[model samples]
Target: MPVSAAALAESLGRVPPSCGPVRLVAVDGHAGSGKSTFADWLARGEVPVVHLDDVATHDELFGWTRRLRATLLEPLARGADAEVPVYDWVARRFGPAVRVPCAPLVLIEGVGAGRAALRPYLARVLWMDVDQETAGAAGRLRDGPELDAFWARWTRAEREHFAADPTRPFAHATVSRRTGGYAITPGPRAVLDPDFSDTA
Candidate 1:
């Protein structure tokens, strides 16, 4: 059976708020690993979501930590609304900013959303269970040749980043597509007692 968002939300609600009064959840995985899809399902278009794509630019893909902290995290941590600047990939510039209000549940979805730097303020981290090769193939198929050169550079950068700081081992749960929906399993970092083989 497919896991329900309400059940997951109930679990997340029990984690205690890590970022001010908001329960911050991170959906992180390899590029094209279905993180965005899972996050969409989890949010169900009701909860607030922040896409890291808006914070990343072509020139500084993974180097937007400072910008994220300044614009998103810091404000939320201070119990205030945050203004996120959207980056225009085609124009290669940051466009208008969007204001994100304080909400009970907030999700951040992207490749490095579960990095160590942000994990401290996250209530839970869910890692998508997809290999890089599979993800890369799917990404290429979806994006086509227009992103071929970009993929080459991204692959190398992703490999180096994950090698230095893997997010899977630290994830509270691992999500993978099942027959009809997704299966969320307890990760190595899950706090459940031994022999509890629960799968949602």
Candidate 2:
């Protein structure tokens, strides 16, 4: 059966606010695992999303913890709108900043969005539930051969990052692609953690 983003959005909104008055939720997974697309569809231009891609740079793919916390999380934690800096992939530099309102439910969407440092501020984490090899092949195909070098570096870095701080084990939900839409199922954490199990 096809699923609708409306129902998912409604359910996510109910997750308790872990970041001050805002419910900070993370959509994390391997590259090309559809984290961005799912998050965009789920948001439907209504919910606020802070993309990890914007916080990452060519030199520092996973070195965005401090920046994200400082620019986005801190403000949202203070019940204020966040002014997030956008990185220009083409220019390979920081571009303009975008203001993300402190909405009732805010999504942190991108690869590694559910890293250890950000979990405390997140009410829930949704993993894409796709294998790294499959996701990498799809990502490479989407980006084309022109970005082969970049993908090579990125894949290695992603592998290292995940090995050190895996997100799947800590995810509250696992999102998998389904015909016409996606399926959201309880993840390991949701099954293992008493708090999540109680709520479920």
Candidate 1 residue lDDT tens string, 51-121 = 99889988888898899999989999999999999999899999999888888889999989999999988
Candidate 2 residues lying further than 4 Å off, grouped into runs, are 191-200
Lowest-lDDT window of 10 residues in candidate 1?
191-200
Clashes of each: 0, 0
lDDT of 2 by residue, 1-200 (tens): 43578877877777689998999999999998988899999999999888888999988999999999999999999999999999999998898899999999999998889999999999999999899999999999999999999999999999999999999999987887877887677788873232222221
Please give the lDDT score for candidate 2.
Answer: 0.87
